[model samples]
Target: MSKISVLIVTYNYGRFLAECIDSVMAQDCGEELEILVVDDGSTDDTPKVVANFPQVNYIRQEHRGVSAARNTALKRATGDYLAFLDADDYWKPEKLRLQMAYLKEHPECKIVFTAYENFLESSVSAQEEWVKRCCQFAEHDIACLPTALFHRSILNQCGLFSEDLERGEDSEWTYQIWLQKIPRAYMEEKLYLRRLHGKNLTGSGAKQCKEQRKQFQKDIVHKSIRAVRRNNMEKNGISVLIPAWNAQKFIVECIESVKKQKFTELPVEIIVVDDGSEDDTAELAKQAGAVVCKAEHRGAAASRNTAITMAQYSWLFFLDADDRLTEGAFEALYAPIQKDGSLSAVFSYARDFYDLPGRSTNAGEEGKVRTYSGCLPGCSLIRKEVFRKVGPFDLQLKTGETVAWQLKFRNTGLPSCRIEYVTLERRIHENNTGRRMRGQEQMDYARILREHLRQKKKGE
Candidate 1:
């Protein structure tokens, strides 16, 4: 048997298949390494392209899903270790050599993954912060599929890929491995380059990809609910609270995004608080089939308070009407709470999605503040119990309300954990509250700083 079996699953990726194969063939690992390419019935010239690579063990099968293709390769693979690469993605020449060295040195580790750079048309960029935020490199479960390498022996125990899942099969498989408490290692190096062209799976199959994301989120939420139940905690259904005011244009998108979360195992009670919108914000929210609550044109601080009062779940996710949740946001948010009984709340990073020039396309870029005062409300997920004890957003303060609350939490010395995952997307548009109330917001922010100083003085 070979030391490592490289499995490449392809479907209509003739354009990039050659480069992927070449990269694998260039690996310098001295041990026996076999390349297995499973062609998933690509109508394109994928078969012809693979035919040129005589060394590759090519197998053509009917159009099965990627999971099935991968499984076929897995069954045929006769190696001690297994590494999968998508046809549109390629590894560095030393990827196998370096990873194998690391794994051999750390034999206790059953799985390992590395960071990767995204190759777009004529330009290369790091994966979006949102993607990185959802999963940290330090943890294998948080790593993306393209960057992972696993031992074949572990597959026997964890089982093969779920053929039923067309998308997010990697996530499901990784999550299962994590649940087994298998030792995992991280290289922290970019070993693979994932192409993000328009014709790629995520871009070409946008709708299907989206549905898969929704299912993934549901799985995470279900797992969290089970964890909570096992601890004998009160089964508080999750309350997804959105604070909206004159957000007619984006309300539907926001609600639809919430409905897509994969955490279907837990009952989700969505509450959209319409803070007296002159526009049809409430109407739009209701049209989207969300439970709407109306309050006199109050700021977001008041809006969140009203929503919490009506919230059935003890945990609260305060999302803006224009923001959205990424694929595993709910799972990431609930994981910390389930692991640590003392954690009062958790916050993740958020990125701007308005497509402004020079703006970071990666998620959670803006929310990566070194200090507590830099944190924003829309980017956070809070526990209702902590919110109740800390008190609701200060209605008196219109601007920097979130910062003010975070400051209070910091002062009280409560455990406020920051999971570097990007769970929320803050849509930046003309109607953003910051742009709308610029002057007043700045003034309120000044007052908040002054109050913080005064409190510090008294404590001193």
Candidate 2:
């Protein structure tokens, strides 16, 4: 059996077939390689072209989609490693050599992909190289078939391409590969060459690819809903509410910390209100098992109120999208409530982490937790009845709603006390709205305090 199987699926690309096959023949790697060309009822000079190369194994089938053609080749492949080459694209001489070496050295990585250079059909020279992003899950990063060389075992886990999807079958299959957690390595060098030709634009595959991408996105959303439901089937107590705005970068880790909370006494449900985020914050939160709702651009107080209404349980714990709950946050908050049923609301200490030069207001040193008089709302767990009695947050305040509401709720004489135990880690980054509170935000804060003093004056 051959060590590597190079697969090429083509319908009617006779002009590019010989050149694509020649690139495989030109590979300088010292391994036994076999080239398989599967033709899907091409009326062109495809058979005559394959006849020119006696070494190439050519299979002729009825007009099936690219997915079906690739699946056919995948099942019949006899090699240990498989490399797919699109009919119009070819690879560099060192493409197979470098990928094989990397895979052998790193057994933990199941698949490896190389960067590709794109060229116009009229010109042979590639304009530039396609690059990978530094981020783990970049929105625009696309995985192409020619860039990857995979082991035969990956097919067992990821499965073959969808035979129905004509255009984006490869994309859908690649997405499944990522979902299966098959480790992959990306090479920075552009070892593959792609041709940008107009001939393939009018094909059936091209039309199906656009529609298939949307369908694949819907599948991901539905899958996320199912996953969240299955994982969070526990008796719930506290409803963790987060008001987020364009927090795509930090929301994943934030929700992950909440999901990792293993509370024996109080099971929690997370609810996130994405207040007009232009990014994927809502989707990421939902994917992380949080019940998500997207609404118009609103202040934090209003957003939190929306989540409070959607909340399923009694105890409500408010948190920011950029911050994280400590390891035993839910348990610590629940412990006090479990001890004292008369307590309407319980507040805990918070560990503030600062990324800027200055430290948090209460936190003395960087990377440490300290007791602050006015802790963030995330440090408090309040009974839903208490919030209802105190009334929803005042929309007049631009910022400092925590302090303003604390003053207002104090008049109601509800039993509330602060615990010594820290329950939340407040991340103070550049994105912190607290740090950027100025102009209208500052004015609104001053007005709340002024109104509080007026009410105190009347009592005195």
Candidate 3:
């Protein structure tokens, strides 16, 4: 049997806490229920009222705001499902019963919300447009967390409530749910009661309160827009290709970084091409849940070409086996692509780290941040079609294949951009091919540039 954890967060609403507890205690839903009351430094008789309900669990925290209070209870909650209710609000006896029934009927829905009506404590002047506009008693349906019952999996994927937001935290979380494309259903029947006393933040007639609310709503909208764009890029999907040659020690960590990306609808496909490694790079990559491909004793360029042929998505990200992606790398890179359709690729800065001798950790302490406008594939996300236009890496150059390929990429006259966000960690060590072959790298660069100029003059 599934259980529901009812979370009630209160500030100074002592007088109404008993009513909220009574409503939860009267729930007729068959599921086991656990009620948690998080008191956000209430100065009133809130603790005394909560003491009346011996079964209710009470937690006290210093005044950290509503989001913090809810998060406090969220950490302690043990139920499979979660429901939020304000201390100033009460629900109908059939509220949980009906919502649970809807969930039982629709197995696909991860969340279900019902309509609610607001009631004011005292009448206000008709001339006060702000109060009239803020407080409405009409029954309406909304994506409110307090009126919704959702599975615990939603938080695992969409993340927790933002502690920075004092108000509209519910709306912000709802936006995350939308970004994750979580299946949800709405019940039209008004089953929740919102008590809007003059002290209520949304119902207050104070000018300062009104201004803060307006600003918070605007910030929420901008955040929602960014999240929507990131979600769209996720829907398009990405194939992360890693070309490894004798990279057994670093392959697992590299693959783990891609797996840690917080994608919702579509998961990133990690393809690791083992370029005939003498070590166990192929076996380790396969163990890390990557699609491992074995190729003959060829260079990283040929391995990358092999992976490109196996790629299933239009978008591609090439990651070096020795390097890793930062936490927000995908969002930073792909959000721009979603916003600008003309962009063929997006690149960013990479934080450099030195590999110390005798240290097992391949990723040493980070040193300086450097931008890669040249050969580093770990710093960019490029469309698969761009390869078709620019052509693949030259097989002749072993030391500077990516540098040579980048010159070809520039010659196509395709649009690409560089963002300031640091999305990669480039490891600098003794074994680095570019660092070891400085003379050869310069020669390769000179040759690629000469060819690029010739092609440019031909086009003219």
lDDT of each: 0.73, 0.74, 0.77
Candidate 3 segments exceeding 4 Å error:
122-132, 136-142, 201-209, 233-460
C-alpha lDDT (0 to 100) for residue 204 of candidate 2:
45
Which sequence of candidate numbers ranks them by lDDT, best first? 3, 2, 1
Task: Please give, for residues 319-338, the per-residue lDDT of candidate 3 as tens digits.
Answer: 99988887878888888877
Local error of candidate 2 at residue 352 (angstroms): 15
Model 2: per-residue Cα lDDT over 75-190, one tens digit each: 88899999999888888898899888878865766777766775567733232332111111222334566688989999998788877654456656775554565666555467
User: Candidate 3 lDDT (Cα, whole model)?
Assistant: 0.77
Question: Candidate 1's residue-wise lDDT over 207-313, tens digit each?
Answer: 44456557766875356446544543334567888888888878898888888888854688678878878999988887787877655676788677667655656
Candidate with more favorable, higher TM-score: 1 or 2: 1
TM-score of 1: 0.50
- Clashing pairs in model 2? none
> Top model by TM-score, which number?
1
Q: Count the backbone clashes (under 3 Å) in each candidate.
A: 13, 0, 0
Per-model TM values vs. the true structure:
0.50, 0.48, 0.49
